[model samples]
Target: MTSQDLLLRILNKLFLGLAAAGIFFGVMGRSRAAERPNIVLILADDLGYGDVSCYGATKVQTPNIDKVAESGLRFLDAHSSSATCTPSRYALLTGEYPWRKKGTGILPGDANLIIKPGSTTLPEMLRKGGYKTGAVGKWHLGLGDGEIDWNTEIKPGPLEIGFDYSFIMPATADRVPCVFVENHRVVDLDAKDPIQVSFKEKVGSDPTGQEHPELLKMRPSHGHDMTIVNGISRIGYMSGGKSARWVDEELAQTLTKQAVGFIEKNKDGPFFLYFATHDIHVPRVPNARFAGKSGMGPRGDVILQFDWTVGEIVKTLRQLKLEDNTILIVTSDNGPVVDDGYQDQAREKLNGHRPAGPLRGGKYSAFEGGTRVPFILSWPGHVKSGVSDALICQIDFLASFAQLTGCRLNQADGPDSLNILPAFVGDSKMGRDYVVEHAFVLALRKGNQKFIEPGKGPKFSKPTATETGIDPDGLFYDLTDDIGETNNLSIQVSEKAKQYQAELEKLRKEGRSRP
Candidate 1:
């Protein structure tokens, strides 16, 4: 037979196999068997590429996180849009780059809702497809208008932004208010004392870490010396709501319990749970149960606790028989930061363990460590278990999920999100050709080549103690060859660097990365 006839026969057989598989799974129909899968997006706070055992952290054992990787599709090239929690969370939810919108930075606890009303969100898209959506833990996206009364019902918040039920931390654990917000009210708050929160000025007569360092269990390394709550000082000032204040150690347990409860209550049908954990962030106070578990101090202990949280959710899913039908994603908001603020012995007890692994820079950096995080997507009996180098981002969840559930969205809805559902489910090996990383500076990554534009800023942020990746001269590195970014190939490959710079400019000017 001729080569043309052989190619035609091979294509015919491939089509037949796909048709058979589609018929068996009802992939071409919207039948009950084809019901939209339940989604559980577990966002870990400050989890780095090397934080999980599966990702090569020898000091920390993350057996549960490894389970997800063992049974799911793990992506080596997955990244968050930015290197900070607030900005990355905004980009993930809004499907727009945080830099495009003003006020999308590290927010004070009292800051207003940065996500505007009527904005289409990931939860909103899922809700449109008849899925009940719930958000629990670490909602640092701000709440209410600019001047919100903590005593009153905080409206125009998560509920208005597509979450059917929300129990969130309002902000970071290190930030104040330092209480859980269930639905629209503060959980266990008393009306007699009322809750008062302030970032600029002192709220009440509560003793601060600055005034009484002896009272603090964990001393602030930098600016986390405001109001004392549960023996730990936070970034902002809070006076009343004693009953509502969350114990620093109990945070992981509380958030995990909330997530399990949300899953149990919404187990009747399709549901979406955004379980954002504050574990491994600053004030690394792990529960007594997890103390000394890692022998690497609070930082490592909290990582173990975070793993436990993942185990609990997975256990719940298995008990309810939701594992097969549930789509669980385990990923981080950004890279790691050892000594963010508190004196937690994260740096001292590191014992030569690299949190960012082979990647240079962490947290607030334009390098791979800042945004490239461990991403795992698991749906038992549906998605094949394997490792993929496909370049995927948390921002693509909005558009990819919309297509997965048959929910239609216009380009206006998710200007930066792309429908890479095939890659997500392990059906395709290829994903986006390039993606942008935002930090103090902007950088573009196309395949193995990375180009960082020139920007003016202090090369190092003294507070976070991170390299800001800012320089007057543009930077370029072939990440495939030099993962540490030690070599400057911009001068050697001037033409390629210029091309990437132009691509970055065009992407910025167009205001959207997806076509």
Candidate 2:
């Protein structure tokens, strides 16, 4: 047969396979199962800029994530839209800044579903383009509509947002009702003993960190004190659901195994997996083998576990021979915090470890560290590997992927997304014109000049211990000379401040910031 005939035969085989798979597994939530590229967005919870070795972390090695970087693009000036978890995840999935939603600073444990049903999402977009999408692990973004019923199927969640399958912890591991929700129902929930949860009153006589400080391996510094699970105190109250609770130490491997199985089953066609790993997040429970591996305590051990998970995913990709076709984007939700809360010796044994690397501020700071994170795009024979300070943000992913897959996200859909396929593939140097960041206030950037809007109320209520948002009172700084914001150009360069303030307003008014 001629080369053209062979090409046609290959295409016909792939088309037939995808159609059959979609018909067989439509109930699993995969609406489309062809044409789209397999997208695996691996997000690390509360992971710092310096956590991965590729980002200059010296304490522990991340050979797997580093491999992705070595093969593709590693972004040095990339950032999460919000400093905190829930809002950041919201922005990531929705392609819109989190501040727009009312009371969207940082959601509490029992809050209703943040992304309402029928919301347009990255996975939803991919599904339309013919892809099997799944989300496994750490879904801090809330679930259910109005009142959630843990015993029954939760609505307006990952399924409503376009994932074919979902196996997730409802909130942070350090939060209440510690149980895994698979797809719609709570995994292994008992009918005989119902589970009850609340941020208000105690559900039962369950041991709490407040009542039993001696039970804690990692003591809480603030906020994270309520129900006790696996000898660790968390945020909300819970009673019963003993069979459904997950083992803390085994969190990483459990998610990894599930992810691998999903990939193996869907290897024949394009798939989208929003794989959120519960590593180094909270409770800091690293399995026996990885415990104390970094000599920095469980926090460090969890870092190792994160690295192993990355390696396993990469190995699985190689095994399936999908490295070249698959587009792998690895990044963290926010910067690092040595002692956000919890005593994992993160500070005591942090030694010279730089969790935020060279950036100042972390997690909840408007500073460089808060917004900037380690961003990588890997596709083995498709992208050239190199560092770029092109000022990319999580909000940009929606439009970027849409452009890559030959799809369009109408203005209403990806209001914050920008097409930068050339940048992702290392063919273009020109990138985003301006980027808006944070949950509290707006910070606009044009080239090296960055200006932050003063106070528009604020997220944390009280002034955070850290510079959680862009300094209010209209601060303008020339990051080119002073990247740390040490010398306030706000007073000195009032004109530049005015310039970016205008840009900030235009961003909000237009709903999408202009490049």
Per-model CA lDDT versus the true structure = 0.89, 0.78
Kindly give the stretch of ten consecutive residues in candidate 2 with the minimal lDDT sum: 24-33
lDDT of 1 by residue, 1-515 (tens): 99999999998887667744544223543232246899999999999999898988898899999999899998999999999999999999989999888899998888889988788999988887899999999999989986878887997789988999999999998898988899899989899979988888998899999999999999999998999998988998999998888888889888999999999999987999999999888888889999988989999999999999999999999999999999999999999998899998889999988999999888999989999998999998888899999988899999888767878787688789887777788777878878899999899988888999988988888876788788888899998879989998889988988888888888778888666
Candidate topping lDDT: 1
* Candidate 2: segments with Cα more than 4 A from true spot: 1-35, 456-464, 469-472
Clashing pairs in 2: 364-468, 433-515, 434-515, 454-472, 454-473
* Tens digit of per-residue lDDT, candidate 2, span 196-306: 888888987888889899987677888677888888889989988989888898888889998988899899868988899988787788889998788877777888898
User: What is the clash count of model 1?
Assistant: 0
Q: How many backbone collisions does model 2 have?
A: 5
Which residue runs does candidate 1 get wrong by more than 4 Å?
1-16, 19-33
TM-score of each: 0.95, 0.90
